[model samples]
Target: MEILMTVIMGEIANRSISFLIDKCSSAPKNQDERLHDLQRLLLRVNVIVEEAEGRDITNKAMLYQLNMLRKEMYRGYFIMDNFRSQANNEEKNSEDGNVSHHFTPSKLNPAKRLFFSTSDNAHGKRELQQSLYNLNNVIVDVSEFKAFLRNYPPLYRQPYSMHLFLDKSMFGRQMEMERILNFLMLPEPSAPPITKRVAVLPIVGVANTGKSTLVAHVCNNERVRNHFGKIVFITENDLKDRGLINLKDRDVVLQPNSPLNGNGQVLAIIEFSEDIDEAAWRSCLACATCLGSVVKIIITSRSEKITRFGTTEALVLNLLPLEAYWYFFKVLTFGSADPKDQPRLESVALDICKSISGSFLNAHIFSSVLRADLSTTHWCMVQATLRGIMTRNACLSYECCVNRKNPVYVRGRVTNDLFAIYPSTEISSDETVPETTLPELLLGGVRCEGKFEVLALKSRIAPYKNYTNTCEMLTPRSTKAKRHQKPR
Candidate 1:
């Protein structure tokens, strides 16, 4: 039985070591499950050790095993510790917790402090075992040992994932964003009180138009960050499933007075796709308006028609200008400003800019694909590819305008009548017209009196085989003798 118990204890120790190694191998985010698994392995080891007759392992051996575990686990702990330290520093700079000092290290127990410190040497493990041995003989409470393990640095790393998600200082976007805090803070109109307090601004454009990028930038801007008391970003799935229900549970309600009711004014920035149904869109809009009378809900979408559904106060961002295009080009090329490459590439870039027509996303993507090649031959090839895309875009634009199911009319006049000759076709604005004299051509059509002229009846008449048939069609059922006029 003694031999069997010793074998079992050794097996448990080996298994515990294996478990610790596995936990160290994975990411810090998965530390919760790893911690639980480690605890279970340790419990098995403790059970087997207690059952063994002559297998009373020395505290030195246990400490040696712990040292091995610490070395293996230190990498993950170091990464998490560094992240936490940096996060805390940022929080302190922002005065987030109203704390004065920023560089404070977390207070930890002796074992954890030793385990985490980079200065701890191999001999320190033996010293720690000796200290524990001396403390164990005293009539002290045994609960302290459990508390020490429970408060270890490894346990601290277990909650790192939650911290990562909740850390607002870590969230950011790459582009520059404009803030309208001053505009929103303007006092309510005094004269005829405008009841429409809530406003929704839906940004619409085609795919790769930088909608999300713009939203992200605007949300992370310093002005917006400082002005709003509370800002929350809700994903599409969350909006659909809960419809701001979770937000309400968090005490974030959609009410105008509530904005001022809390600590200060709160602005909730809700982002959703254009694909959301009209009802869901309405729900999101309602939520925004509920937040405050001066609530500004900014939405990004690929459809132009989303403006008609909710609030009419929508602003469309014009596509990138030439200056912005150059800025974006420089960014994509990583500041490779060679004029030799520019002359050949400028025309192609212009054509691409015109084709994409101000979409930052498109420009960025196209530039990224081309920037991979450093050779002049690749630039030439890119020019060729851009020309093809331009041609295709022109064709698509024409098709979209011509083949629309319900064509738009202007002042009760059918506009499609002019383009009925060719369906889904477009003529360039630069095309020249054929030379022809209007009166001469019409006069040569038919003769009247002494001069060559066409009857007024023929000019205004409906479709007919010839001028005579046209005249007959217009010579109406009215018997009143209307004077017939002819060309002089």
Candidate 2:
């Protein structure tokens, strides 16, 4: 009796000690300390996401929370990584005897403010605080996530590094993919099956924001293919007032062999560059009904008006945040090579990314150029060229299509002449492309006269689209002639 009583007293004492320790630790940590915790939490969340990616999760609520978690993870990672990059850059600048980065505000000491300026330091603090608050709220909202996570079995670990993952899979769209896949695979049984009121999903986003790629990826999924019999692509050019009846010759058929397991319904993929009206969408659906129970209709457009047409809620995709884009671009640029090994090159790579804005095609193209030659000299040249291009028109890199807002001109290195440039239409895998790639042109190894196409980087993923810009060689706009012109 005495020993049992002693043990109970000891247990109470231990619990009390533990409780106090937990309370003290939980009491607001310092900024740097809190960031360390945030990093660990984000890594934990990343592992969970990687596991979740391989499995098909159906809980809409869970899926939504996962999206929030992934986004916060990216934000947290960005903050931490940016600080590290700044610190290293400061150290590198010191070693190279370089005065300092062209940090804004001249009154500040260049040596003292290596990592950040007064404004930057204050701004960074606020950003970190807001990030922590937002992440905490997301975690609190999804308190039961861990409990649900236990139910799903883990798949074999995928050996995908950041760069490899970016190369193979769609970056920043895993949750979106899962959401769409679940929608297609398991139709809502609550709706009468006989009516065959087929589901329509409208994917809306800005131009070149992967709206089309997402639809194509979901359509090509094995599970989705097994659920629907026929897959057809209908472009803005293919739509007729009569609806989808005459698509036999018009639309491209993706899958012909019936999987024998599916419900034997057609899956129509419609793509539009402009806003599609209510009547046109309904007509497509009406024609779909005439075709005997089209199970799914997937449409993608840049206009948000398409959202009204979805039977389910619309999925909107935007480009990654600047920090996230930098992280991705850095990985792609260094690829298998460590950024630590070449800090100067890494700094230059950031400039190149900014010059191109958020253009994914340009990201791939320039990253390829950087990776091809890891030397700082080559990277610097690329940076200067991109800067020159931006000086002409920055938006040129943003859009893959030819209808650019401002004309782009590339000056001949030797001839000192300017040539007008325009991007060509999408080139497919089987189609013939120009011999001179975009990198070749920027490198200035070869210069040709007259109009010709320069092949930009091609997609390694589905849709396999490539960009080729047309360069119209022209007589140099004679600055000498302007100099001699008399005042009007």
Candidate 3:
């Protein structure tokens, strides 16, 4: 019993010393100040114990009273530090004259302080006085001592566990993913019978084409979410174990057996790689086909070849139209929509769209890079840079098409002076032709293929509506053909 009392007294002394150190660190500095404060606190504890001795306390009762006194001293020191720190910070703020008037004290910290102070005051005096009145009553039974400790309110320290709370953006993504699952499982008229129509969809496009964002948008759309039973999305460049492939397969096979059933209408959207090896492609395809007719698989990739593998049809995602690009740009620049900046923002957006030529990825990235600082000079620079890039790309595309050896042609009607023919390729008209006579060229290489005949040419005439040049070249000359003609 004496040993237990001694341990309790030691704990109280340690807590008192720690409280004094914290207070001194924050207070106006004085040499050896914390040591002096701790000595003074200990002297007060000794005085309380001496006062209890005069009331006829036995050895055991005196020890219990001393432990109680030490606990009270520690509690008082902690309260003093709390008050001193607040006073010190307020003084510093007032002296500097920089503290904001908008600031308000926290309700939680002050409430905790009041609760601790009330309990310490009630227990320390009553327990000490009762122990002195009767030696027998001074020594507490072990069970009652435990009960006292339990009944006392706990000290409120600054919490470290509050970090578990999530931010808004993370929650939004989770909600979006949930909504997409609903859309992918929706019933469709074009859907194949529950067993045969199960197919994989690979959405392939170049870099920055908004593949992830498009998937997010489709999943979030109310119409799509309501129609589908289960929509599962597999993000790109993840390993097999991370639900890149295996998790997707389980969703299709184990969940629902029929498209009409709640689980069977699983829309598995996968991401394919630009340079995926044959083994990986085969594995991905096998996983996709596991759902039979009920599964609709969609993959987004930069490689066109990846889309063609084990798939019936593919839809190419084009660049965003001008208006959509404008909306995206506005959102990126200002957190909220600003009507005053609309004209300047639109001009900048249009220039970027033309340069990227409908590439949603390019527009998104470029907009992000320029979102900050909406200055006139910055907008002008962005426009000039995009125009330069567009001009360069056009020149390169034209040159590449023109240099190819194969003759390219587009089917179009001929009329008027020039035979207008649409070229099948991007080559320039001037590069292919040695002569201006377009009609004589058309008749030279007319060849038959099965039922249809084709005319191959080195070059085609401009202004495709005109055919007068073609007619003159096809006309027979009066002197040359008659002598060679046989008597009919």
Query: Evaluated with lDDT, which candidate comes out highest?
Result: 2
Off by over 4 Å in 3: 1-197, 221-230, 235-245, 248-262, 275-282, 288-293, 307-312, 321-353, 365-371, 378-488
Instruction: Compare candidates 2 and 3 on TM-score and give the better one.
Output: 2
Residues forming the 10-long window of minimal summed lDDT in candidate 2: 105-114
Clashes counted in candidate 1 amount to 7
- Residues 1-488, candidate 3, lDDT per residue (tens digit)? 99999999999999999999979866652212432444355455545433432232223433464455534443343333333333334434555786734233343553333233233444533433332323223233323443334433433334322111110011112222333343354454474354445555555655444455557556545445544556665545444555336644444222233244464455666665465667776565566555444666667776777656544455555444443344344444444444233534544554454455444324334554455446756665556644543442323233333223322221111221111232222123334332433322332233222222122222111211111111121112432453353211
- What does candidate 1's lDDT look like per residue over 1-488, in tens digits? 99999999999999999999988975443322332333344344333322221122223333344333322222222222223333333433445555533333334432232233322334543433333333333213323333334332331223333222212211111111222333334444433334435555566655434455556545554455555555655557676577644444444433333343453345555545445677776666666555544555666665667777545455454444443444345334433354323433543444444455444334444565456665656655555554543342324342243223322111101111110111111112244322321111221232122212221111111111111101111122221232242111
Cα lDDT over the full model 1: 0.39
Cα lDDT tens digits, model 2, 1-488, are: 99999999999999999999989977975555656666667767677666666565667777787878777877776676555546556656666787855453222433234234322566776777777777777766765876786676654465667678788667777678887887787655655556766788888876667777787788777777766766777776666544544655545454556554345567788888778777777767776655445467888887889888888999888777776677678878888877746656766776676656566776788888888877777777777776676665435545443234334666554455566666445766788888988677767656777778888767898888877888766654543443353211
**C-alpha local distance difference test of each model:** 0.39, 0.69, 0.42
Name the candidate, 1 or 2, with the larger TM-score value.
Answer: 2
Better of 1 and 3 by TM-score: 1
Clashes (backbone N, CA, C under 3 Å), per candidate, total: 7, 0, 27
Against the true structure, what is each candidate's TM-score?
0.36, 0.77, 0.33
Candidate 1 global TM-score: 0.36
